[model samples]
Target: MVKEIERKLPVVHVCTIVPISQTVGANRIVPAIAIPHPLGDPTKTEEEEKVIRRRLVEKALRALQTEITEQTVFTD
Candidate 1:
């Protein structure tokens, strides 16, 4: 799905596991919080978790804006 989409539009894959994203040909990858809750942390306060999730979403947006010739993982 990622590769096929990339052919027509820029795409970012936000996942907890980066290797799997790379294996599947995801060009832009954003490291996520966990497998069960990729965008959130249950241990955190609800408000805090929202902030974390927002940051991850912002990271994905940044990844979409970035230009790369090969697979890239945006950890920051």
Candidate 2:
């Protein structure tokens, strides 16, 4: 489904629980926190979590804008 979607769309950013972006064959991947809480860490304070989430979102947006021929992983 991901490959098919990529074929139709100009850009697609994928967020994964583990470091399986390459294994899954995603062209653009944003490394998420985890499987259950992909956006937040329970150990972090609310403010810190918010910052982390924002940064991840920004990275995803940048991945969408960047041009690449091969699979790429965006990290903090």
Candidate 3:
């Protein structure tokens, strides 16, 4: 799906989690917290979770702005 989207919209940024990113051959990726909770950790307080989510969003935005010749993984 990501590839298809990219093929149709070359300027659009596509990013996914780690292992799936590898599997799908995604060129842009952001490390996730986990499969079940990719953006938030259940064990964390609401404030902490918000911070985590914000960081992930920031990483994704950065990924979209970056230019790369190959696959790239953005981490916090």
Q: Which is the leading candidate under TM-score?
A: 1
Alpha-carbon runs more than 4 Å astray in model 2: 17-19
Scored against the true structure, residue 2 in model 3 reaches a CA lDDT of 74
Q: lDDT for model 2, on a 0 to 1 scale?
A: 0.77
Off by over 4 Å in 3: 10-17
TM-score of each: 0.96, 0.79, 0.82
Model 1: worst 10 consecutive residues (lDDT sum): 11-20
User: Candidate 1: TM-score?
Assistant: 0.96
For lDDT, the strongest prediction is 1
lDDT of 1 by residue, 15-74 (tens): 998999999999999999899999999999999999999999999999999989989999
Global lDDT of each candidate = 0.95, 0.77, 0.72
Question: Candidate 2 vs candidate 3: which has greater lDDT?
Answer: 2
> How high is the lDDT of residue 51 in model 3?
99
Worst 10 residues of 3 by lDDT: 8-17
**Full ranking by TM-score:** 1, 3, 2
The pairs that clash in candidate 1 are: none
